[model samples]
Target: MLGDRFVYVAISTILAFSYYILPQKNEHYPTCPTVEIYRPLNYSENKDILDKIINDETFRNSSLYKMQQAIRINTTSFNDDLPLDVGNNLDKFQHFTKFHNFLKDEFKLVYENLQLNMVNHFGLVYIWEGSNTSMKPLLLMAHQDTSPINLKTLNQWIHEPLSGDYDGKYLYGRGSGDCKNLLIGHLEAIEELIKIGFKPRRTVILSYGFDEEISGFRNENPKFIENIYGPNSMYAIVDEGGVSLMNVGETKLAVVGTAEKGYLDLSISIEKQGGHSSIVDKRTAIGIMGQLIVEIDNNEMPTYFIDKNPTFYQYVCLAENSIDIDTKLKNDIFNSQIDQNANENVRNFINKDKYTAYAIKTSQAIDIINGGEKINALPEYVELMINSRVAVEENITIAYNKFVKDTTNIAERYNLGLNVQMAYSDEIIEVIPATEMGKLTIKPITMLEPSPITPIGDKHWEIFAGSIKHLYEELAYPDSKVVVTPGLGTGNTDTKHYWNLSDHIYRYRPGVLPSVNANSHGVNEYIEFDSHLQIIAFTFEYIQSVDALDD
Candidate 1:
């Protein structure tokens, strides 16, 4: 009987330990530092002006109607056929030209040649020059291209995919969320501003690239930036990348991305003498290559923290408080204990599925492998392809060299001939925070570092928090924290393009992104109608607050 009691107690303890170690849902996460809140002046308070701006039927109907129309037009613009090429299709060029002409007619925008090179394609840029001649311009950018869908599955859309059905609430179609909305939002915002006779203190330029989906390879973007900003004239630029609404314990937080990780594509090959089916060798080239892949998957890059980028730290800190004791320990190792030794220890404790594990480590996945040509015979050569995300501080070259050396060492142990080479490597951009005085001297102006770390606090953060809270008080999770994240983005988008041009680059999309398998870059992509309205309100409030600055 005593023995049975002992076993029961032991089982209970083990269960408890497992529970403590498991990752908790983010809804139970703790809150980080709160941002300052401000009540925006009621639009009614500035009724005459606000009314003229908001209630302009021509402005509202025309802009929103045009947005809906553009959504329909652009959705059909996607090439459903395989091997989608925007460069080759003359029809695609015509679509862009029509869109360009429409903007020129509606906004009085001058169509000018970027004149990069004769080979470089011609792209359109719209400039809304501000009354204040001294201040550098702000660029509002979005792409016009849509990634082609599979022809067979294209008809599976909730709407015709290209139908652009308003349904009185949500805009259902492709490019609606990915970027078409952004394009419409900018145009509508400008139209509203124009209706109120409100001119920006700084010039606001709207630039659309036709081939952002396939990388702006034609050099249209660089040429456009140079032509407008005169080499180095941009005050700041905003692009699309990181915009997330995360549940932090009882609070819902908004994360704005400031930096992105770099990408590296690598290939490993092992060569050995061909052998007969009957003569099997354990240390064959295929075996060596498989071992190399396993080693990479097992070994993670060193974890480190960027004190300058506070968002990631804030996330870790919140995660620590929200999770159970064992999970908290895991969070601590990732956020604060990123030292070499601590990371090694954490690596042993946690599995690969957790966000903490991915955040602090360089993830390696075997994307492709080629070995034996047939079931009966071993091929002379085996090739392996791997994709790795290097940590921020780790140089791509250093990481690549380390990978090669490590593979070589493993191959030598097996007495196999191995060759490793980098297929392609991209540099990671770091965010650096800066401060600027607002037009209102009393109001502090803050900007993220050219290379900011995650979760850093800034003036724009306060504006975002305040604007969101003011507009969505009912849905407002009080303990919500505003954090600037640099590491959250999975190195997606052409951030590298803008990173080269300006220091004050922020990536955010104002919407309540659904948690359960939100369709982004996938089928049935859609955004809620209320979310769209809220985002627009937030944008208006943000612009107003920033423009009110006096200094």
Candidate 2:
């Protein structure tokens, strides 16, 4: 009789796990509506205008040379590996004064004409006052900082990371691609326009902030942003979020970021007691943590392949004709677009493209871990750090509640007493027993929800679509016309702070040159000099296009 009862319970447990892990029936997905986007038929006259601007032999050569000079500066925030720099380390940002001086010299035309002010010297803002002050201003933004270079991989780079070596085709350096390129592109465009004796009809604001790479991102120039372009005063704001160009297979696509994913850091801890490793227990602290990790991993937060809500998938679905995905997969997307029970085949299909898969779901990665001290001693405490990108369909509150419930179930399965409960705020620390809950505790280290999704129907979307279309057309690549799509950025940008002032927030960097060896934080970061020029072209067109907007 006892054996039969144990077997019955075992079968029930297996079935329960199977039901949670593979909820194959809950295929019902929210549907993100597709915007009516049309591909360009003929290259616009704006391309001709941009070509004329770049055709200036004298201006083009000098501007490219000066851009290389700008990249050569050691304007980095830290020395590779050694974060804390002592006296006279030029790259440790003591050279910032020199960098600023170089900018002032290189863009002499900009300073001589445009009114400029330093936001405490750390943040740089340049204002070109338009003739029509009544028109809402356009703000262009890019970060001034870059990630710290890794010393262990320093020798692996083709050129010195700070050398800004231009190898006739590519400009190689730390900040070359991650951001500095965009900043220089904007600056170069303005400088050249000034040389051409061009004056704007509407105000143009350029903002460069520090601390984008740091953990605690503190903006150095709020007052400047306030006094110039205050709340509800700006028409549109652009920042680096997504690539202006991306190629899935044979087809080239121009992607503009309309939304950014939210972030959350969870530290899962399971504590018991420490003893000699030889003294075996039914389950150790590490064992409990393992079970919890497995539970979360196996029963990952449900991902949406299709549903009623608007998602980036809608854009991908529209581009289905362009992408090289299988026809069956495309059919699966449509079949499950509205059903509560979406086809599992569709989920499997979309998840195949790691890039597109993430935009549709909340992602979690276990990044950090801490536990035992010595091999001989058993671990009483185990902690794991999970970094999650919250999806638009879910909030931190809802997602975290699920996490707690999952933890509870997992704990109950192990027959472990979980005296501790989870709370989401700040970093987690190991402590002696305090409250009487049980053995497990989960807490959030950091939490930030996804950014608001900008509407594709707005005038800002039209301007973005137009500017990107023109920019891509001028590239003359992909052996055919490019398709434009609204995308959700997997990462966050400084534009998050500007959400209050502008609703039409866009995150995109103009032109992405496809490369097998791409590294945003690793060795040999670089960008094609021509790709840099495209940003300037896009900036010119975007401003021109928006200037036509009725106030």
Candidate 3:
């Protein structure tokens, strides 16, 4: 009996030691309470609007027809190496005016009621005067441009790329998925609000850039953004982003993008002595270029678990909510704050999913490489372009410095002169020796630092997130539970331009997950009619929710 007691105490001691040493799985993390409200006067009226959106066939068809009309007009922006005023390019830009006309014709009420201001002839800014001018206007943004479709894959589309075909299930088109849906949806919401006699207490400003695909509006027409909506002029800016509702185990997540990755394009040029193929040198420009590419690939940047990064917080939310996540992973994610090993483990797990990995890590791609004019001759010159999406944890200067550091050894070994074109400055940074065999030049074709992260856990965030949750609960899903968490956008958006306009900018487009994932820039690009409706309904409810806020 004494021996049995001793064994029981020994086993209990081991269990206690293990419990203290091992990372424990936490089922609760920081989460915001759902702030859902409907003004008593508009409560029943809003419900009827939602019901008509869902059940009324004529209402639904009208919305669908508007989307089709917007998509049918080809507002495809081209990234040609020429000015807008150049030969034939001006004709290409005329398409935007056609789109503008279509908007005026289709949404007659919106055109009639709201005051429109055309920025630089193409950019659209509409002001819907609210009852109270004291309240800062809510800025709703959507680009009026679509990525130009590749002619090679034009045949791969089910319907013509510009058909705007509705097979009674999917509405097939280019701009339909990526933005026109949001643009038209915003109008649909406003048009419906007008019909229902709902006057907002806060002003509504709709801003649409014509050349978001090419990143033109911000650079060309800064006068409008600076003069009209100067620094911190708006209440909040909501652009098209934050991927639709995603599911983790039984918990559905409405991920809202609080931050976006910076963009940098490094144009690397190598110059070497040219020679006949018969008298080829051991090392040519192409050969050295190949080696540099390999070295850059091998020396990938370490993915850090930054506290400021929204993706890190997203995993924390997932660790607490996702029951189907691996036990070890969940524990590591929770302990990552204090433990370095746990942090690395969480990063590795995040890296396993490539879809979400880019949001946390700086992404590099050898997009364009040019060398060798002929097979019989050694190339005299070669050029390579490396596109990098800078991570939120780092800035443009750090990213640029890292590239220079990584390739310094290779440049030294080949006795090549190094030249770096500074991003923000006009002066060229170079280290060229008189006896150098070759020259290596690195220049940034375009450089944009990561956007300022929108503050979370604030009144604006709660209202934005709460509106999402309320929309999902009341109209979107009705049955499924949704957890609204801040997410990081892997790609840059037009919101990058409007950062100074408001600190409370949110990048989100409400829709179902699977349908939202349907080929954004690829072939078979389409948008489900049902998902489109959700966007319209969310916009309508979201506007009203923000209007009710006191400050």
Candidate 4:
């Protein structure tokens, strides 16, 4: 009997250890076809093409200097005086005029040839007319604005967010790496390309949207570009998104966004009898709101990856390199049958990595909740703002429905009045009578569906990949190898609105590394001066090569 008891305790201990203590990462396994380092047989340029930009020491220094100046100016989006549907984020269009004039002064060659149009008196569009009308134009995009920094966090920065300080190695500011690197880097290349008499046979358009950080109430910039370029006329649109390249231990991957997830905001409000805090009951508005949060937290919709190629996450898992996989891990991913246990392991593995999990399923976060105006008062109302990013397999309607069903159940359990909007429309979908009337209300403040996937089977992919090859060969990891693969952006970018204009949209933030803690779109955002130079070099080659492609 004692022996039986000991065995039972031992088994319990083993199960607990496996469930709680084991590492979430499992990169050692692979059926990954995209794991190999890609090498092209032919060269896009005579290898000397990279020299034109690399050799121009004076030009390179000037470009980086100009970038620093650009960052110093605050283009932070504000609730400005503009029409709501236009989605103007700038405090005023006048704020962008100085930066526009600055660019014109710095890159003389660019403004001279390209017809620089100041859109809506705030946004910018630079046109470089191509010789061939037969070929669609190539578009490069990035944003001019960034997220507003809190005044309270000013001292927390190593360098002030607006100071635009270059600390010997990094150019520091709010928008440095997020989009400015590409934004300025491309312009730098164009200025130099024109100086060297490198003319693009294919029309090249550079779009700088004023508001990309907040994801406008309307996709203003993309729509404007679409109208000018004509619907679906773009050969390709390159924008900032996802990890352009990632480094995992010894293995490196050149990442590109072939598709991106969409997002929406869900607002829930609850009201009850108002009184002093001392008279609080078992179910005040705040108390009921707290429980609802708990239920939502405990009942997150499980991620399903049963179908082999249902989502991009599965495709990435299958395409992962064999060399990265060990025998045991390989068996676990492949030999294991498509059972509940196997699927559970895969789901856990994905959720462990911050990036891959988002690619697999829709995610939720309760970002904002407000109740009493005063602490002492028995709060009469509470509102919760939920931000959800939907996966490619799901739609906005389905995700919104699930939210309604879940929240409704919560309201019923608490016997509270529940009001919620099922979607983006003005009509309120549900009104559950609570202890008080108008006690609860939930509505969607925003909604954007996931983008369509742009497959990689054309010369466009090759030319883009070829650009990576040329840049990496001369620049990237000397020892660590890189495999270029198709990836879906877990978050959206300026490219979101440009989707209809092109069948092929590639989001690659050039001069960025595949590393954690990149500090993008966060405090202490910075970019390596060297990477910026290489990006400029890469852009020069990418456009010149595309110009050579057959019609």
Residues 1-551 of candidate 4: C-alpha lDDT, one tens digit per residue:
99999999999999766643332234433233332222323234434545545555675567668888888877777645357444354445457667777777877888889987766656788889999988888889888887788888787889889777876667888777766777888998887678668777899999888777767533365667777767998888888765655665445567777888778778877777788888767777788888878877787765755432224333444335435433334334552334457556656776787667876788888888888889788887688889898877788887877787777877777676676666757776547655643356777778899887775746777778656755765555455456666676777787777778988998776665532245766677778766777778778777877777756
Number of backbone-clashing residue pairs for each candidate, in the order shown: 27, 23, 0, 11
Residue-wise C-alpha lDDT for candidate 1, range 1-551, written one tens digit per residue:
99999999999998777644664333433344455454444454443433433345554455556666666665333423423333575554566655655655655422331111212343545666666767766665777776666667776776776676776556676677777667666665555555555656766666666666654544366565676567546655666656446554444455556665545656665556776877877656566666776777667566544443333444554454443335645544443443455445544543344544544445566687877887778677676766666555554665666676666556546644432334242332211111121000000011111233323345545554555555454223344444323335444454455555555666666666731234656677676644544444555555556555432
Q: Whole-model lDDT for model 2 versus the true structure?
A: 0.68
Highest lDDT: give the candidate number. 3
> Candidate 3, TM-score vs. the true structure?
0.93
TM-score of each: 0.69, 0.80, 0.93, 0.86
RMSD of each: 12.5, 10.4, 2.9, 6.7
Winner by lDDT between candidate 2 and candidate 1 = 2
Expressed as tens digits, the lDDT of each residue in 303-402 for candidate 3 is: 9786688877777777667767677777778777767898899888778887877877898898999999989899988998999999989998888777
Descending-TM-score candidate ranking: 3, 4, 2, 1
Could you tell which candidate, 1 or 2, scores higher by TM-score? 2
In the range 199-275, model 2's lDDT, one tens digit per residue, is 77788888887656653144545456777667778778888866556665666666677788788877677777788
Candidate 1 residues lying further than 4 Å off, grouped into runs, are 1-34, 38-68, 74-95, 98-122, 152-160, 165-170, 230-232, 271-288, 302-309, 316-357, 369-382, 420-487, 514-517
Q: Residue 439 in candidate 2 has what lDDT?
A: 64
Computed on alpha carbons, the lDDT of every model, listed in order, comes to 0.54, 0.68, 0.80, 0.70
Ranking by lDDT: 3, 4, 2, 1
